[model samples]
Target: MEAIFALAVGIMAGAGIYLILRPRTFQVIIGLSLLAYAVNLFIFAMGRLRHGAPPVIDPRLGSDPALYTDPLPQALVLTAIVIGFATTALFLVVLLASRGLNGTDHVDGREPEDE
Candidate 1:
């Protein structure tokens, strides 16, 4: 499972980089989203991927590391997801407004034929 998560992170990062280099506003937005997801996954993975583990330590168990899961990474990932979503929506709206004003979706405010 760890290997799978690592592979997924790598794939997302690579695709995000590729998309970010493209010359389109929409691709750049999607690339940013992918990069945000990769970061979220990395942050979550940092807290460990233990299965069937409880979030809090049991007092009677006397601090058994193997029986508990870290809650910090989960909380951080949750916050990141919400922020990423809002930023993505904002970017989309701004992109739409820019397109309407300039009649182009290119980052430099010029049509492909003009370049």
Candidate 2:
């Protein structure tokens, strides 16, 4: 499971980096999203893998930490996901607006500004 998580993170980072280098606004946005996903996954993976248990303690069974996965990583991942959605939405809006206003979606500007 750990190896799988590591592989996922690596793939995300690699793709993100590749996309980020592209000279297009949309690609940059995708790269950022991928990077965010990788970070979220990495954080979630830090909690370790567990199955068939809830983080909440079962009073009837007594407190045994091993029975549950750490909840902190789960909470962090949830928060990250929400933030990521908002960020992606904002980026998409910006991309659309830029295209509407300038007729181009490249960061280097459709027409070079006079210096």
Candidate 2 TM-score over all chains jointly: 0.86
Model 1 poorest 10 in a row by lDDT = 106-115
Clashes (backbone N, CA, C under 3 Å), per candidate, total: 0, 0
Cα miss at 82, model 1 (Å)?
0.9
Give Cα distance to truth, residue 81, candidate 2, Å: 0.6
Q: Which candidate number has the best lDDT?
A: 1
- Any residue pairs clashing in model 1, and if so which? none
Q: Could you give candidate 2's per-residue lDDT for residues 1-115 as a string of tens digits? A: 6788899999999999999998799999999999999999988878887766686788876788877779999998999999999989998998899988889888765855674
Candidate 2 residue runs with Cα over 4 Å from true position: 59-61, 111-115
RMSD of each: 2.2, 3.1
